[model samples]
Target: MKEKSNRLLSLSAIGLVILFLIAARFLTTAESVRQSFWALVPPIVAITLALITKEVYSSLFLGIVTGGLLYSGYSFEGTLNHVFVDGVISVLSDRWNVGILCFLVTLGAMVQLMNRAGGSAAFGKWAGKHIRTRAGAQIATILLGCLIFIDDYFNCLTVGSVMRSVTDQHRISRAKLAYLIDATAAPVCIIAPISSWAAAVSGFVEGENGMSLFLQTIPFNFYAVFTIAMMLFLVAFRLDYGPMALHERNAVEKEDLFTTEERAGDESLERPLRQKPGEVIDMLVPILSLVLCCVVGMIYTGDFFSGESFIDAFAASNASTGLVLGSFVSLVITLAFYMLRNVLSFNQCMDCLPEGFRQMVPAILILTFAWSLKAMTDSLGAKEYVAAAVKSSATGVLSLLPFLIFLIAVGLAFATGTSWGTFGILIPIVVAVFQGTNHVMLIMSMSACMAGAVCGDHCSPISDTTIMSSAGAECVHLNHVYTQLPYVLTAAAVSALAYLLSGVLAVSGITDNPFVSLFGGLAVLGLVLLGIRGGAGTKAE
Candidate 1:
């Protein structure tokens, strides 16, 4: 009955989208709409349909169509060509995307190899004794996620691979696990000075020490800090609300790691039951090797072997090529280790290859649609629209500038599915707006922008980090998005309020003490959660 209701609701949402498009066709000037609010319709439609319908593929496709129509003046042939030829095919044809897909498949294969060799199971057993409680398991996951701050992609998959078995053993839902992985990924990186995110952010600023500036803004990054705090609070207090609470309840009561059947019976596609005897060392060694090789590969791509500095190499490295190289090497090493240890035969190892590819098929499919939707949104000029909007709106709201920039950044990043792009477009404008004076305002605004970008990325479905987080936890993509949305919104709301306070304080010369605003945001978040839980308790009674 519930499934049927969901299907009907999804259909109704689709119907409404079609009506909206039809109405928009006759009502608006489509071709001349670039850099307008119309440019954001695609991702907005996609995100809304995804939430309402609890599906991703159709929502993204419809969004692509909507974007194509909006970009091409509602011509059917134009939309057909743009949506398919200029959008999906183009993205698929891009070398970077292909490399990322290949990397994902290769990592999938490695995960399968580990499962076939009993490495994952062995680690689970080893971890089970020490990680006896759900809170501890979640804390360990958060720690792993924070530790892998080199890249968000690496953090999501690596943390997921290592912690999946442990979380499953403790009856933690995949949705919750994905939330933890996601909450820790970009949020942690924005503050980690050595991370890819830090480098990406630093590259966006002009005429200043970007790294130094980024560090200065860290104390004011209320969203990222509050997100981490919220995770710890939710886990420690068992204060999950919304869909996540139901998921947690189901997992605790039923030992069901997945609340939905979007995946196979087990969260993993690999057959652990037919595995060979292996110790935790088998798992730890290959994973550690993968991590080391990936770091080396990243620096190698940046010419670290040529005597270049580590930080510069990391800043210059191509994540796709590095990940692919590292994962491929790790896969080869794992297979060879299994053979030498006689834990799995050559045939057995070879057999797991296709199985691993099969396991990651769901993620690949979602990523393809997501990439396509982003392409459509890009083609519709969402970035230009957002940049112009922010620039235009910055004229008179000096006191509210940080809050306004943060909100603009959130909408832009959420629409375009790129935090780097969001900050890149806005940070310069921020610099220009506060040049030669207002140093405190500039730093606070930059932090607000950074926090907003991360928050939006956290909420965006087409975001690579969000997709990878789902893959890491082996959660249904939409389920992860749904369960985590309330948490992201909570953090974002508090952060927005904090930014508002900071923006006002900057104008009043009280911006130096950002901790005051941050603590206030955290307190607000706690109070909000308590109020929500109290309401829920009343309803339960």
Candidate 2:
């Protein structure tokens, strides 16, 4: 029965991909065979194979093959060179891409180190010791995820990996684990002031005006704030959606949703225990120091202490030196503490470092390929074509700009599996459109784009953060994708309604009156919550 269900799911996913391809072919204005083929075929092929095989490597390989075919047409030799030589080189050399790769490598290394040091085990032990109720356990997972706002990729993978044992021990499903990680990733990134996302968002805003851009957009970033709230609310109420709700019930019955390998080193930590007084401090000190140093380093690099503007300070930190330096310092301090306590010998620490590096290999590979795909798509002028289509079609519907931008941003992000690329393409266009109009509208439109990109990327299974979350939870990758889609779509539907109201209110000159938009957004959210409750109740009945 399970095998049949899996087969049926795979077939349905394939059908969806086929439908998307058909839609893209009909909608795209690009007349070139190459442009049309690449845009339509790659994602379809990748997703189809992924759903059918339920294998990460197979999905990734097919994605690469589809991309290569788009780039080099039918020639095997041409495809090989484009996919291997140019793709790899381009990803390695580009600064932003390099930063992403470096961050992933460092994150993987950090997770491995934490695992080796038994930090996660210690955490699981502590949680199981204190958190006697299922509600407490779920709340702990959500709070821990919220705390790790340094980077979405870092948060998703690390939080899920660290909390998985605890959650599973407490009878939480893998689907819920994926949901917690997914909920935190984009929601936190959108709100975090000091992250790679902040740098990217700041760049887009600065390119338009300056610090005012950040200030104006913050209030309208409803999805970011609302999503986080929803996650917390769900945890507080023990609410679940669709298949996720069923998984929760199964977990209560102690039925495993999927097989997980038990690590050989530590199986007894599930019993939980209080850390010695100084032990928690020892773990926290390095983490806090790392964060402080990152902030100070960013200020120093950006020359903020020397009286540079906010934008300039942000631009300076774009080098990623701050993150790299901060991570190294944290690693050294953590090792020193272990050495001082005789927890590990210097030789053992040195040996562990190599293992840490080895663990990052998969992340490095995936990041390299993801970056390569971004580069190849950019080189093909895909962004320009998308920009052109939007500009041509939405000429005078200025009031609809925010909703339109949101739709376009979401569509592009979903297709490309990249929020950064979507923002890079749309922000400039929106900025230009609002150059002579109301700055408030401009801010709302840009905010909509950011929120929409995050929404789409959060849902896209091919997204690096999404894939990492699945990997972290040790769940079947496609299962994670399918399970989370409904929740994401629910949030997205509310978000779209919010964007539409924001646009209408902003354009009608009532935006300055906060209550109008605020009440309007609240009304939509109320309806969404009612719908969710009704649907769940109906299903239960």
Candidate 3:
């Protein structure tokens, strides 16, 4: 009865959201306002419905239907065209979307290979041998998740796969693992000086005013900075929230939330004595080589070394190509090392490759749909409409530019599920908005866009990271989405408040510079952290 009631409530909420979006569309023909308001509706409705109904497929399908309805409302013929041809083709052909899809496929393949070769089990064995405490295991997982900042999808799946056994051994919930992966992916990507984000942002800004724009916006991207800090702090201090907190409490009480089959991986840690002398080295070497190649590739892309053409290097790091090549190379190395040592038969390795690819089917599907959605919206001018609406609405409160930009960016990214799209739409507008304002204000606006996009993406159930995080942790997609939303919203609220304060201070000349605003925000964060810690300690006592 309760479940039925929840589902009905969710359906009602979704209907209301759709109605609101339709009304908003009717209210404005101005591209920006229409896009912005419409953009806000889908994700909020999708997430709320998913949470209430606890159904992933239903939630996603409803979003797609809503999007299609919106597209159709504009024109019946256009809607048919998009649904039949454009949606499918756009997902398959777009460069950015394809890159992510390829990565997901390759990652799934690699993880399967690792499992087949006992590499994943081997790593878990090694970690279990060293890290005995539950807290220690969780910390290690978080740190490793943080270290893999090149791509959020990669970070989520890779970290979750490699560490799942160890985390389960420690009685940590899969939900919690998903949270850690999701938290680290965007936060780390946002701050990593040399990452996909840096490349994307650099490209957007360069197209507008060249490389100098990248330099100008770095200091003010406070949400990213503070988000990463918050993740680290949560790890160090053992902070958890709501369901996550309940899971941690259960762990402390040695209660089991996972099934016996789920805990089977942990048992593997106890019986891993069958590999050859060089098997471990075979696994470690390939992973190390891949890391080295990626690092060199990133540097080459950055053209940081003197006289180096960054364009060539950047082209070379093709994340999909790199991962594919690296994984193939690793497979070859593992095969040869195992063959010479007589550890495994040729048939076994060959068999594992197909299985690996098969595991990635779900991720591939989700990615395709996500890409299609992004392409459809982009082609329809949804992003442009949203950006214009946001700019116009916030024009009167110019002093609140930084905070407004942050909210707008979040809204845009949440709707589109693409930070790159959000940034591309907002960077120019933000730059223009702050044209004669203090340079600090410009920096803050830029930061707000970057930060807001991340925050929105982090919270949006439809966001790729959210989906990937579910895939990574093997948590039910909607469960992961629902469990993590509250935590992300809390962080966003704090970040929003920080941005507003920074804006107010900047306009009043209290903090006339970016450095001052950043430091002031950090100081305020510190006080908040102190209160959080004090409260936690009191509860503990």
Candidate 4:
């Protein structure tokens, strides 16, 4: 009955969308509703339907079609061309997208190789002794994610691969694991001064030293800081709510690793090739090499060997290209290492290439649809509409400007699935908004933009970081998205309130200390956790 009800709801929602598209023709004769509020409707539709139906691919495709209809002014031929040709084909055809896809495929193959060779199994045994509890596993994953703050792309995949075994051994749901992976990726990167995200944000500023400004803004980055805090609180206290709590219960009580059919990978995460130590090197060596090579590849692309400084090279590096080169090299090195170890026969290793690719197919398809949806959203001028709206609001409210900017930034980033783009578009306008009138407010608003962008990116299902995290944890993509949303929203609310207080404080000339809002946000987050988690021990306890 519930399943039937959900289907009915989804169909009704689709019906509404169809009605809207039909009505749009009479409302506008233009080919597209570019640079308008309607520009955001498609992604909103996509996100809503996905959440409602627990279906990702169809939700995204329908979103693409909605954008097509909006952009082509409800013309059938134009909608088809717009969605297929200009949307999906364009995104897949891009070289950067291709590079990332290849990296995912190659990395997937490497993971398969390690599994078949008993390397992963061996590592699980090694970790089993040290990581004795679910909290330890979660915290360890969080620490690894923070440690790899160099790039979100690198952080998500590396943490997922390294930590999966430990997490599964504790019967932690992949949904929860994915939430941890995602919660750390962009949020950690956005605040890390040495990270690729910092580099990207710095380039957007015109007159000021971008890195310096980013550093200054870090204290005011409430969403990022509070997100980290929330994760620790959740794991340390064995607390979860909503879908995640259900997943956790299912994992621990039922021994059901995945509660959904979307699980393409196996409990290979929990199974070991051996209970001994020899095969341990199989997992560690390649992971280490992959990390080493990826960093080297990133710097190489930035022209580090050509005499550029470490930071400068990283700033200039093309992450997509760097990761592809790094993963390809790592795969070759792992294959050779496996052969020499005789853990798997050469032919068996060869077989893993296809198996790995097959395992990654689900991720690839989802990513493609996601990318296509983003393309449609972009073509509709979503970014421009957001920028214009934010600019119009910036000058209207003095005490509320920072909070309003944060909300706008979040909305834009969530809809478009790109935090970098959201901040890139907003940061300049923010700088211009308060250039000389109030220096403190300027900093606060800029920080809000950064914080909100990461927050929105965290919640977005189509976000690259989100997708990568799901792939890394081998979780069903939509399952990860839905489970993670409540956690993200909890932090976002606290951050939003903190920013609002900062704005009010600034109006009272109490803006000198960043710690005011920072500490206050932390307190609120803790209290919320305390209330939600109770005087917590693990669920079993």
Task: Write down the TM-score for model 4.
Answer: 0.94
lDDT of each: 0.84, 0.66, 0.66, 0.84
Better of 1 and 2 by lDDT: 1
Model 3, C-alpha of 250: deviation from truth (Å): 3.8
Query: What are the per-residue Cα lDDT tens digits for candidate 3 across 345-381?
Result: 6776566566656766666676666665666566556
Model 1, 96: alpha-carbon shift in Å? 2.2
lDDT of model 2 at residue 241? 71
Quote the RMSD, in angstroms, for model 4: 2.3
RMSD of 2: 4.6
Error of 2 at 377 (Å): 2.1
Error of 2 at 256 (Å): 2.6
Please list the residue runs of candidate 1 whose C-alpha ends up more than 4 Å from where it truly belongs after superposition: 264-268, 273-276, 530-541
Cα-based TM-score, every candidate: 0.94, 0.84, 0.84, 0.94
Regions more than 4 Å wrong, model 4:
266-278, 535-540
lDDT per residue for candidate 1 within 137-238, as digits (tens), equals 999999888898888888888899889989988888899899999999999999988777777777888898887888899999999999999988777666
